[model samples]
Target: MSSARTVHLLRHGATVRPGLLLGHVAVAVTPQGIADCIRVAAGATFTQVVSSDLSRAAECAAALGAPVRHDARWRELDFGAWDGRDPTTLPSDALAAFWRDPDQAPPPDGERWSALIARVTAALADLPDATLVVTHGGALRAALASACGFDARQVWAFDLPCAAMVTLRIWPDSAQIVGLRT
Candidate 1:
């Protein structure tokens, strides 16, 4: 009998500015972030490990163990001109509109919601069985939305704080969300 394959999606630890829009930025994970990753690593078992090419995710993946393969496909949504800006700095109306309809109102030059979901779904589909994917919050949300039948707006509602984890059992025929681990 074939065993069910488990995929663990872990959000990277805290960034320099937790509230900033850090899409595609190579921000270093904080010391506390490293500690949180170490703590998570201590309790879990993974057959394979992968991470986004971004520094924060990569560093967290490394903390889980060695042989971490970084993939740009797993990177967070590229915010383009808004990459490192604080959301508070943007016009409230524009920000609200973007949040309400991300696919239609993408950040200037940034990736659209549909594109992000497609890329992240493809990346997850290509992973090995029992894999651990260390990535950004946006990437994790995209995966959740794809695998768990969540809508774009509902994906944003998920509070995937730093170092949070969500597990899914994926099979050839279907996928089941195991649970979220804070």
Candidate 2:
């Protein structure tokens, strides 16, 4: 018999603003976001619940009444000087440069998408086959990109919504996206 694991990739609950490019910043979850988590976890069971160390993610895990294992590597990409900067504020050329190849054209001092992917991969390696990961949209995109064998640039197109859940079945050398937006 073949052994398989189910990984639940949950984007953290909603925040104060949707456009705030938050990276490593401590932000609180909106009340609705908390309720959304509860709604999602109503009768779900999992081997473990892990989350980014950020307060938003931790709080969501807490509301689920599970012992969350906080992992720094699961944190969102560090936006550095661009933290909290609205995307619309970026210069057109600069934005185009980043949109073209975010893995290389990083913000003034922000982390590259490749680094973020590596961190998330390492953090995920230790998880059991069946685990629940509460993280950010960027982290989820990274996982999707890795599973789909796509380049880092492809992750930019996966705009998952807040509090969304993405399911993946990972194997030794391959991974599959089973379901999304649960």
Candidate 3:
């Protein structure tokens, strides 16, 4: 039997524009954000650290003092034309529809929710045991959905604030929620 693996999914620190859809916009994490990651890392020992190539996640991963493996597959949902745009700027009806059913109404030219889940799960599949992943909120939510059997709507309802960390105990055939640290 494969030994159980512990995967810690950490949301990157707060971004420059907290209210905007930052998909691939390359924003930096706040100073406090870096400190937040350090505080979390101080208590946990990880075998490997991975991060999305985005600066926010990468910077936070660097703060953990581990050699990071950067992968674009762990990136936030590609918002396409809506990337970096404030949600309030979009038409209310369109925005509401997208939120109500992201899988069905992705932003103009953006990645669908199903695509996001697939890529995030694929990245998770490649991680080593006892790994830490620093990524976007959307990506972390995808991990929760994939490992915890949360549907799209349920995943969206979760509140994964910036710098939050969730640990998952994974096996070849199953996964368990270890803990959540906000």
- Residue-level lDDT tens digits of model 1 in 39-114: 7755556888999999999988888766888888889999988899999899898789889988999998999989
What would the per-residue lDDT of candidate 3 be over residues 30-143, giving only the tens digit for each residue? 999888877876666688999999999999999888799999999999998999999889989988988888899999999999999999989999998889999998999888
Clashing pairs in 2: none
Against the true structure, what is each candidate's TM-score? Answer: 0.94, 0.92, 0.96
Q: Return whichever of 1 and 2 wins on lDDT.
A: 1
lDDT of 1: 0.86
- Candidate numbers, best lDDT first, in rank order: 3, 1, 2
Error of 3 at 120 (Å): 0.9
Q: How far does residue 113 in candidate 3 sit from its true spot (Å)?
A: 0.6
For model 3, name the residue pairs that clash.
Answer: none
The local distance difference test score of each candidate is 0.86, 0.81, 0.88
> What is the Å distance of residue 98 in model 1 from its true position?
0.8
